[model samples]
Target: MDDPKNARRSDSLDLAYNAALTKLDVATCEAMAVSQAIDVENSELHLGFSVQIFKKLCSHSVALICAVPRSRWVKSEFENWDFACAAGQSRAIIEGFLLFLYLSQTPSCNAEWTAKLLVLYVNDCTRRAKMMANVKAVDAAEDWMRQAEELKDRLKLNPWFLNLDGKTQKRCLAGDHLMISSRDEILELAGWEKAEFYAIWDLLSQYAHVLPMSFTRMEPDGRGSGAANEADADYLTATIAWCADTLHAATNRMTAGFPSTETVRQGLDSKFEPGPKENRP
Candidate 1:
């Protein structure tokens, strides 16, 4: 028989995990509804881009939601869970949420938005060029690079882009994303503290990158089976919490963009807050 104390812990974790999952589901639904309702063709460029970003975030949320049950099944059937894989997916969700917040929101100046779009276009071209070059498609790569150069020239011509410092201007021309604001500033816009978010991000990064920290502190279970146990539960709960928080934030931003969704958004009462070092043992 399970100890009474352990049973209580299990019950509590189940409740918390379920609650977080529900919040993620509701938020994602809200995002999807908003995405479908928006007329991207008629919207301004910034608004259209925002819709696209929000749609991507919604897709990430859906994948995470699906992974939760799959992880549970793996733990029960195979007696093992892929925590590292989930960590990487959670990191992607975090990044998508942050980026959606950054690009979807109205900028102080329209020109800034235009400049951002141009840089993104240039980055896309540069990435495609590199991919083609990797496949030894020299002519295709050169064509992509030429298009990127044209974008760089256009970006340089923008008054807002030219107003940036010389170093920033150079970075923009080189296709650096996130140059619109410092990392901390972008997090602040999403109501996240830089230190706290970075701490969790660093922890997730360790697993995502398969770093030594991810495996150095492996404590064996009493049964000598390193399968499903409290440690895995903790990691899974923390991942759920992170997904809930990020999707919640994204939902709020989406509602702001499409006020009609606010009613449905407010109906989601369950919310999760992730601390700076959540799940870090």
Candidate 2:
């Protein structure tokens, strides 16, 4: 009854759509398995191994999903593909790699290992700052200083710190004073804060769909300006890069801390927050 050409076209479209959906389904299952593995809370040894397994699963999922036609895949296909899903997958991969590095290199292994790694980065930044200060590289020093300042400001605005309010701010500031006695300490604190801020940013970025994507780089107003200055542009680039890196690292840390399926199920089973009951007669 149908024209031969139209029938062929319809069949082809259905085939493509079905194939894409099947691939997406496989990717979702793989991603969920990986998440479950990461979520298993046990000894660090077990956790670390689980995380490695999870990473392998994620790699496989990414390859499989990517092979499918992008046009056929909806946002939900990628978004709900994993624990954090595709939105946070890139960050999770980077974080897993970092954790792999830390476990292999460091003698001490604990929950705070990631924190220590951040401290090391901070120290490196500080040493560079000092070395630059001694040289006639005023421009370089100023540039570095600007980055540090931006990080500091960002840290202050971090949700974790913001949530603490008056008491936590005072305590944290006091602790900073005591802990940041040396250049190394100062650098470590900067690094730690920067890393924390980055993790928060990555998590929030998952929900960027609800936020405004457009913003003027040159002027405060939404109107498009001619262009931004070279230095300003450079600063923005560096800041964005740093934030990205920090977020990736933090995501990795959080992923490593994820609980297993059994644990999640058990927790859910153990607790129930009841809603308001209807009025009795």
For TM-score, the strongest prediction is 1
Query: Cα RMSD (Å) between model 1 and the true structure?
Result: 7.0
The reply for model 1, stretches above 4 Å from the true place, is 1-3, 70-81, 216-226, 261-281
What TM-score fits each model?
Answer: 0.81, 0.24
For residue 244, model 2's alpha carbon misses the true position, in angstroms, by 25
Candidate 1, which ten residues in sequence have the lowest lDDT sum? 272-281
Off by over 4 Å in 2: 1-3, 37-281
Angstrom error at residue 186, model 1 = 0.3
> Per-candidate RMSD vs. true structure?
7.0, 17.8
lDDT of 1 by residue, 1-281 (tens): 87999989978976775676666666655555555555666666676777777777767766666566433212344333446646777888898777777787687688889888888889899999999999999999999999999988888789988898998787778775644666788888877878889988998898789898778766665111345556656776777677877877776766666666555433333222221122111
